[model samples]
Target chain A: MTLILTALAATVTIVFRFAKQKTAEKLRLGLLALMYSGAALMWTVDGFAAMFAGEPFVELQNPSVVADDAFLGICVLFLGAAIWAVGLIFKKATKKAV
Target chain B: MACFVVPAAEAVVVAIVKKRADKAAKLQAEALACGGANAQTNTEQKARTKTHSGEKISISKKLGWLNAMLWGGTALLFLEHVWHGEVVFWPPFLTAAANPADTAAMLYEIATSGVAMAVLVTLVWAGMAIAADNISWVKAALCKQKEGANQ
Candidate 1:
């Protein structure tokens, strides 16, 4: 799950750099990437430490919690990315018309 | 985090505007130069003129405020953390340990990370402002080159 989130975040970050409209798309995608990667890194490191040390991870007992957190994180990331992408496309179209 | 984003965006916007203003200033200078104005005299006069003019006033003034706010807010947040200790909603598990040495390490890490992020964000903002200020010259040079080609 951590790896998934990290990958998603990194993907979004890369996409952000290439989508050059210099609009909100950049911010939305960049922030989404940062948030997802940050959360993923935080959770993955913590989760791994707990698993390796034979200790109970904070959200380990709640299988739903892990899924829920990851879901929410991904949702935010994707939503932000989509919004940014749409905005960029719209901006480009407008610029072309002008 | 949101606080940081606002300032960063503001910085970027300021930078863009500054670049535009710089381009305008440079074009004006080039136009003057093409008309046989003295290089040094025109530059000094342009500088004096800009100091009095309001062309780039918006960017400079807005960015100045943003810079102050970002740095000030970051400092206040850091001081708040120092006074109250780690104030994050979810303290990391390692930091939750009761051992004094472990706790100290965690606190140090948190403090260092916070400071580093704040500094990094502030620097980004500063760089944006500087870029905004200089971008005008870049744009002016490009425009002038284009114009020369047309001629």
Candidate 2:
């Protein structure tokens, strides 16, 4: 479900980026697409692994998978935020040039 | 140390950005002073009578707002997972629920997050409008100043 949501987010941002004229906005949108798409891909691989291995997909009882996924999602979110901050700098640059 | 180092780096970047912004604004004002801005320039007040109509919001602003909504929705979903005291990192989705009660809970969560995403998108759109308006106001002010000095 999280993966689906992340993928949806990626789609929305990428689609909207098409309409934007400014580079700064595009950069932020591109970063968002990268983050969400990456998270979604990670989850999809986890699902495939579970299917191949004949395991209950979620295995809520297993702290291992849950912990790992949560950690990864958090890391992705943080990384996205970091890139967004960098984009802010570029945004200022773009604004000045315009 | 990561926290300190990160902010310091960000601050330096921000300083550079601010300096550039001011310089750029001055340059644009100078350009407008040279007659880059004219009567035909888009404006909402004259839009009804004008052939091209008033200025439309830029794609960049729209995309920026959408990007914000995407992040907002993701954050809400993360919070929903944390609230359950367990992560649903893996998903058979409803099938993973062992009982009817668990299934109901899972469905409820999905519904809630779906609503949250919608709400976030709406809020972002409103914010974008306000920001766009502010930008226009600033531009109008700049145009007025340029015209005044010329007259």
List RMSD in Å for every model shown: 12.3, 16.2
- Candidate 2 chain B: worst-modelled 10 consecutive residues by lDDT: B1-10
lDDT of 2 by residue, A1-98 (tens): 44554566667766765445254243555556644553454344445545666986555666876776566555545555566667668877987999
Best by lDDT: 2
The positional error of residue B2 in candidate 2, measured at the CA in angstroms, is 32
Question: Model 1 TM-score?
Answer: 0.33
Q: What's the DockQ for every one of the candidates?
A: 0.09, 0.04
Point to the candidate with the largest DockQ. 1
Please name the candidate that would achieve the greatest TM-score relative to the true structure.
Answer: 1
Tens-digit lDDT track of model 2 for B1-151? 0011222233345446556666775676566557545633533235333212224543443444444444433443344444444444456332327577776755554454343334434454566456544566533432333333334
Name the lDDT of candidate 2: 0.48
Alpha-carbon runs more than 4 Å astray in model 2: A1-77, A82-98, B1-54, B59-61, B75-96, B134-151
